[model samples]
Target: MVAILAADVAGYSRLMGSDEEGTLSHLKALRRTHVDPAITAHRGRIVKTTGDGMLVEFASAVDATRCAVKAQREMAERNADVPQGSRIEFRMGIHVGDIIIDDNDIFGDGVNIAARLEGIAEPGGVCISDDAYRQIRGKVDITFDDMGSQSLKNIAEPMRAWRSRIDTNSSTVESVRPTTETAPPLGLPDKPSIAVLPFQNMSGDPEQDYFADGMVEDIITALSQVKWFFVIARNSSFIYKGRPVNVKQVARDLGVRYVLEGSVRKAGGRVRITGQLIQAETGRHIWADRFDGELADVFNLQDQVTSSVVGAIEPSLREAEIARARCKPTERLDAYEWYLRALPHFYTLNRESLDKAIVLLGQAIAIDPHFALAKALAARCYAWRNPQGWATVPEEEKAIAVRLGREALQDGDHDPSVLWMVGFVMWQLRVDPEGALELYDRSLSLNANCAQALALRGWALATAGRLDEAVPALLQALRLSPFDPEAFFTMSALGCAYLMARRFDEAFKWTSRALRQRPTFAPALRFHAVCLVKLG
Candidate 1:
């Protein structure tokens, strides 16, 4: 009796079609260097090889199973850095039974069963028959998922199958171990990147876990549609579920700069979701908040949580990017990097920092003329300078800002960030309220989770004396971004909307809320002082 292992490259034809030469080269090198050596070390003999697969025979079921698991695990590590669409993965199956050997090539029911099992295994995974599982059960330090009976193709009887789980700590040290003290970090993308960790279920019922998982999945899907963001896939993020994880390590592993983690709790027919966004590299908490709603409206509650979480995360990531920029000298950074460093200076609303922001933004634009976000932000500085009484020639600066804003919109109309910023420049620099409102509406349509755009639309409506129209958008923005970096902006907008509606008490309440978030925020302070004076 011999343990027969059969393996096939999943999607081999598709891979070949994408890059035929590269695929053939990689596959051949992998077999020569890793697969053959592993088999030899485990006392297995290659029976035959096909263009896209191979068959091997081992003296014992345990050795065959070990070799398969180790090979699959190593293959995963090898493909970790490969682009998702092009990465090569394998599905392996093992079976143990009597085989008829002819001309040193094995043949029989054993090889047929193994091939059928391979058809049912997952990519980057291993599956074994009942006979092989029974032989290897106590011999190896690995666990198998009972896949139940699988009706394999061209097989007479249903075969009981067990799939091997990727053991994170498998003893395949030589191939699977970290290469150095600092394992290679995933490279960051051109734009901001983030990974949403699986939310913990705190409801004390495993059944409620699905609700939390569903929420995260929806958030991931929503975030992916934001265009500028590079969101990690759900399968990669969920691997950390049920494990105590280090946020920084996860960020490095996933190659994301930001991480979002939270928990779901349900009690007495109400659901509560608490989430926190973290700057993984710096170990800083950027924002945190909680939402509560009745279970009867679970779907709406999920939407609320998703919008709020998305809204909060954008500003949090922006702030973290600003902080990072401040750490390095502006001269040392490139166009996009310098632009990121300039944001904190602009947000401080001070004369000196605002000037500094414009200068940095200028350098960014010079480096990359087509950089739409940099252009939009630079235009904003010009627009903002007039309001701060810092621009010596206000009309000239306004014209320049409008020109840049239009240029940004030319290529970046589809980008939510560009639309929002350009809209702000339009309103503040050119005083084109109609144009700003149109842009904001377009932005919201593109990204429903755009809290800042919603807040800006509210502010615009309130300032134009459309209180009823403004109030709902402002309140929704606040609900979505409770810990927003621009909390004062949202709160003050809500207050102004209420003030325009002749609700003086509610106006005072929201203005005070803004003050609580940022004691000296100019807009909030003005709103609070105005509300108090109205009451007097």
Candidate 2:
């Protein structure tokens, strides 16, 4: 009659290693304030809350996922300041099958399967049975990468699973690729990367811009304070400002793997803001909310938003990192380091750096061409070669890059990195704007943390003369990586958009800001030069 969701807090014992009382206090606070309310809102019932975990029953899977994501997002944010090792990460499993209800309890094989699935879930992540994944695919704007059928403890049949760490809107959202090839290299130490998209300046008064602009800065600062997180610098993110972009492009441009974004609206004495936390690789909306409050509560509003974002992101990040750490190297392989080094090179669009990347990637592929990162990066190098003017007669190189990029996707497009690289290559090389756009869009649907993908898509939109749509994407890129090298791109694009729309004065102002950051950066320099010419 009901589906069961079983989840246990990862590192619960380690977190309570020497401070049982403190852990209990935090957990108790979480339950009373976040968990209980979310469940009630979603029309679900909590069967029990164990000291380290909880079991809940839902009449429908949709509400169950919504409640679970909400609980995880809030709790993780609350614990952002805690030491990394002491943080609590929850792994959840959902199973829709027959269940038995007793006084104050729910019992069934469904519960056991759910627990097993939870055991397999990435920390701060969700794993659902094929039954559950199938049920909710199109019902909600979320995404999942298939884990294939794997044998679980209680379920004899192969259990189909998906990683639910990222939101459906992540520009970098992607599922694990399905293939029988040997495991590819693991890249980078698993610190989480995220971008915060710009908040729409919904205030009717054009002068209220400062509040909207500052909100993202405040968010970036709050998110960066968590020691466990690897927040992107603000500069790189601005590249996406005022531009429409898919999430995957955001992830690519910033060299980060994750992204976060929201909007702000101030009217009268009250302000309303809507926020969502997304996994860049998987464009899934892991957590989202619309909050309304008086302007006087600005501090509280910022804090609450930070809490939710940190809560939603940290656990999932830890889980992803832990998964990487847990992978064992194959014979004659140092896959982890190889993967780590590849991320930076793969995102490199410069000629010299990309050339170097090609050599290293070839080595990686030779060692394990099955290495997903290597393939993706190689494709990216080719994709960006010509437009970036990185190569002489880039046409040949561009074709090669496109061929290899799709090859990489076919090899394992589900991995966030691989899919993101392929998508980037398609946009920069083939100029198949539609195909590129779809891939970029799909990437974010899987993860919202992909600021690079978002930025790229934003630029694509701007170049195509779609000024109105480009604004939010570029703004998001700025929020996620306030200090990214490419942030000026977003600023310049916003300046350009303002110009195209005949908002001349605004264009001049933003272009001037961009010039301050990088006087010689072509995009900003050109835009700024033009503004001066037009104004004079």
Candidate 3:
């Protein structure tokens, strides 16, 4: 395996359009003075150059990472006083993997991943694969922020990414240790709010952890579908996993009025789930229940838990809402199990994991072809694969995605999760933006708190140049899921909306916030660059 680094000027096309000769001259000069020296010093070889971009090979990930950081720092200093619109900034991505060498050219998944990483990287910043990060963690003194699992275009499975932090004040990079300081407790939302902690696995077998975790995820999804409930996103709530938790403290931390804690035990084709809803402010047990059922009836038990919790929160909750929340994803237990198995892999966002997820979801669909949720998820995986450059046959995957998505819509019109997931696939795969918007509307009508649908709707609106409608939807998504891990996506969409509205200052501010949260987010990076040019 070898370390590969890919980098390109962030706005090279625009720069070239404005001043072709000047842009080329500046790029050459920067290479000679900063880029070339850094590469040579770090023992890296330039594989090729594509006008504004270059591919390099390094024997060591440490050398590649150090080289990238050094070059970015130099470029930052170089562009310190340049006109914002004229400044040239580079985005870099690094990955360590096996490569094929032919005719003095290097090619493979390694090169593709590195290039895709560069595509999503922040201008003037570096993004590295988890493999590279593992190699350079203690060897390099620079601090790195975990970017979680990122879906790179055309790359299979999701890969965890890390961003190197650059200290603008000092020549030497410094490590910033995570602090124990927590933000002031957030105020509860206007509506009823709750956080469901990960259910404890009491089955004695460590392998059953997925079973319990999936159960919690389903509960969270069910509660989120309740239009009047403000439920914390799974990512935020899962932070308290495998640890002791204080209900009141969790409420304060998450800004929720209620906290749900539970345990799941499975043995001998039988499962028992116990759940309790606590009023956070007063530390009172609003409701508590234990459900016992055959393993085949796990879905019913989950629905019971959800209905009990909702009823506890508001005893007068309408029966229609309860029935809607209790919609069964699939009647086949085996298919449900397969679907559950696919979820963890899906979240990993790496090529292998994503492929595995697709396989699992496929199995689920085969077992129950009418399983709308499974089909929707499978379509989503295909959609994700296409954008990340992971799909080997774009046309084939597109057709499959469209088919699965359409089938899901036909079968799951009343299922909010199905509507939103299919809508996302439709919007992302460019099947139909208007249709996607309508799907989002339908999803919100069923589950008003479907933040993902809201965010995607806002993104679609902004992309369609409907700034007026996009901003509020995006803002509402942020308001509903304040602690959502993907909130940066909504923030970036808002930036795009404001940018199209010719509100450059607001665009800059929102994009800046997004980059602060996820520096490698491509949409935000692109919008922020434009905002800089417009403001200048």
Candidate 4:
């Protein structure tokens, strides 16, 4: 593990466009006199530099924070007399985490988090991850303001951040506000909405531009197919192509809640595609990832990237929307907001949370009788309650569950989520395994990357004595969503599939893993006990 520091000019493109020669000259002068000297004094190593940014490595977080603070102080002095538009201000982010060293350069979450933190930093300021903050807190004399938990793009979980409070006596940090001259911000659509910007061709091969552009188009098309999303059209998003953009501004202009941006790089026999999704309103990263494959399978690579991106962002956006709903006044929530509010409770997998989820979903359905997703989720909740011994009226719940499941299929058979959820309800209630299988298969046909559907299908197949097909389906679901909240359920299902196939050792392995995630999961415990008895 090492401390990584990422820094970039606030408006590099605009500065270069205004006066290319002068900007280049000034940047070189600043590096020579201020930035480089500060890094050297603090014992930081310059790992790499781009046209307008640099990545630095340090043995300690103290050194990295000291170096960044010193450089910003010097820059503040240099730009004291410069006009706001022309000042060469810098934003810096620091993180201390494990890094993958390759060819004398570094790659990994350490580098990615630092870079994303830099993206959200105020100009002439520094942002550091909690890992770095813990290392340098009270160790360094500089003061830092807690920036709370931030959802950085690509990183799996939200991270707490700290921003160094630049001393007013030494440097003045100015807040840059958005211009009022542009058109008023567009209202966000009813459903979760997003815009996918064209991916950059980072391979430096002009010919590869087509490949990158095509991938973006394909991703946009795929995301649009997810009935829950209100995806911005291709032409609207493409207008920002080849331009440096502020993500928050783009969100306003496009009237979207989320924005997706990425780059494609091609090497000799391989290509790598990287993508990150960010919340437009708060400039927070929601998700980020990279996909790599052989050039021979470029089209397949495109499809893979699209499926993985769409699949990953769906849950992320849902969680983000749930958080948004939580912050709103309870009386002001609409039907969609009510549905969003129910999700966290449902995922808790406990009796009380499940009861609350049912109530919230009932409220949502009352507001909009045709809210098929709510009905489907409510049906699943009822189906789950009976198994957990939480249902006071089992027969009544069974009838309600069946009625709601049928109504959901009638209203939203086209939606993959609704289909898979209703399928689970039917299967859990022992309605018909074959019918449930058909619903699962149809859901997969709609969105092959739907991990929940794959997991449910695996469970249904295993219970129906189709072990061969069940095992692979469950494994694929795990791959698609390794960190999924419902992963324990999949792991448990895999245990059952293995147990049914008389693979006692594999059953023991998966059941043990599932128990680690959810110790009291009854199905996994039963499978684990059976596995131990069989192995004995």
Off by over 4 Å in 2: 1-336, 344-350, 515-520
Model 1 has a clash total of: 0
Q: Which structure is stronger by lDDT: 3 or 4?
A: 3
Candidates 1 and 4, the one with greater TM-score: 4
Prediction RMSDs, each to the true structure: 16.7, 20.2, 23.5, 18.4
In order, the Cα lDDT scores of the candidates are: 0.75, 0.67, 0.84, 0.78
Clashing pairs in 4: 153-285, 154-287, 154-288
For candidate 1, lDDT tens digit of each residue in 1-536? Answer: 99999999976996899799999999998887778888998999999999899999999999998898778777777876665456677889999999999999988999999998887676677889999999997687667755545667778886777776454455532222122235455577666677888887756566556567756765665675565666665656766777656677777776778888887766555677777677777655556667767755555555555555456656554333211001111122256556756765776667799889989888888887777777888888888788767897988988889999999888677666678889999887646889999999988776654667878899998998988889888876654443355767778888888887778899999999888877866777887888899999
Residue 17 of model 3, lDDT score: 100
- Judge candidate 2 at residue 291 and give its lDDT: 73
- Candidate 2: tens digits of C-alpha lDDT, residues 1-536: 56688888875875688689987897777778987898899998778888788899999888787777777776666655654445666788888889887888878788888998887676667888888877787775456655545667666676656666634234233443222134332233267667676665645445555466567755765565454556675545555665545565555555456667666767556677778676656555556666778866665677777777766765554333221111122222344235435544544445677777777667767777566556777777766567656776677887778777777777665554456568777766656777777777766655454567777777777777887778788877666555566666678878877878777788899898788866766667777888888888
lDDT of model 1, residue 182: 58
Please identify which of the two predictions, 1 or 2, would achieve the higher lDDT against the true structure.
Answer: 1
* Best candidate (score: TM-score): 3
Per-residue lDDT, model 4, residue 182, is 53
Candidate structures ordered by lDDT, highest first: 3, 4, 1, 2
Candidate 2 differs from the real structure by a C-alpha RMSD in angstroms, to one decimal, of 20.2
lDDT for model 4 comes to 0.78
Per-residue lDDT over 1-536 for candidate 4, one digit per residue giving the tens place of the 0 to 100 score: 89999999976996899899999999999999999999999999899999999999999999999899889988877876775556788899999999999898999999999999998776788999999999998776566755556877788998988775465364333333234345555677677778888888766456556557756755764675565666665645766666556677777776778888888866666677777777777656666667777755555655555555555656564333221011111222257557766865787779999999999889989888888878998999999888778898998998999999999998788777788989988898898778999999998777665668889999999999988899899986765444455678999999999898898998999999999989988899999999999999
